[model samples]
Target: MTGGPATPPTPRPPLGPELEVRRLGRFDYARARDLQQELVAQRAAGEVCDQLLLLEHPEVVTLGRRTPEGAADGLDLPLVEIERGGEATWHGPGQLVAYPLFLLPLGRRDLHAYLRDLEEVVLRTLADLGVEGERREGLTGVWAGGHKVCSIGVAVRRWVTWHGLALNVSNDLAGFERFRPCGLEPGVMGRVADLAEVPADDPLLEAHLERHVRGVFGHR
Candidate 1:
């Protein structure tokens, strides 16, 4: 291979940032929360490196830390209170949920920037799937054609972040129609299947998202 002038390689995130990924097909909400609690403690105590949990819940609605009053008044699903900061969102089959039990980057402990990074991951993933995903002003999740395809509600404890992002691949949208997520109007959620011609298998998408996230964070 010959070149007139060699192009400089692109700079990547610092390597060797340990990341553990767990993919449980269709897991429980409460149990996953408990597992996150355990991992957070372990991570803070130096017992574990950065960890990422990827799974889909069986139709559950989580009330975020900033969710408004009566946000989920009449939902027929279990209402779980979590430490994440955002409004309510739904998790169910066909969506990809990722919780990164990570140690915030040294000297750059900015939560807002981290949230934007999460959005970039989802957007890139969508791009790889032949879909164009963008960000909406005054919103935290990734959007496509003015509809939300991914929802992010993050919470940090001792600079260790948890409660990550969820991307809709092919989930049943009826659940989202039941509530106003993030104080946004109802019926504004979307899925990758809606925009892509490829198959929206959860496991396949989960694997792809994991790869995208690993590269985005540059965790070894």
Candidate 2:
């Protein structure tokens, strides 16, 4: 009776790229963005291995490529303009933001395929937490019971991805009302805690996400 199919979903073929996962707890939004920029360049140049940057940002609103002018007009949170895909979205404590600095190899340069892979990882992670997540047709994030619990928007530079997805865990979702997220109504946003029983101090959310990412992408 969860959100997705009763039977387990099919596993995706693992990309098995070497990945370095870094957890930066309570990081600043601007600083994290800057770090991703640096890492993307390094990864593109083969100076560093592919990485998965996991962390939470303080309250901030970001405008992506598809965001309309003044989309963040009335939000009191610090606003930042970014190059990621999608519209305005919020990030704060209790939400996990993952920036995967992955350089697509010769045969894996398909953006659509990469996005679906990310969705699958989130779906599997939700399953681990007893929350069944599903994908809405033409939508980019994972949803449970018709509410979107994750928001994904990525940008690629020289086939290396930077801006990535954010999964709402226990964040204050009131700020989502200030603007549309991915051009959808504010009420469309959902959190894992709302659907599953997540202990306030539990580390399982992050652990599940990391494990699923590695499992789906075949990363070590």
Q: Quick one: best TM-score, which candidate?
A: 2
User: lDDT of each structure?
Assistant: 0.79, 0.83
Task: Please give each candidate's TM-score.
Answer: 0.90, 0.91
User: Candidate 2's residue-wise lDDT over 1-220, tens digit each?
Assistant: 0123322344444455678989899999999999999999998898999899999998999999889898888778899999988888999888989989888876677677778778888889889778888887677888896799999999999989888889998888897987888889999988888888886555537778888888767787
TM-score (C-alpha) between model 2 and the true structure: 0.91
Candidate 2's displacement at residue 31, Å, is 0.5
CA lDDT of 88 in candidate 1?
88
lDDT value for model 2: 0.83
Runs in model 1 lying further than 4 Å from the true structure: 1-15, 199-204
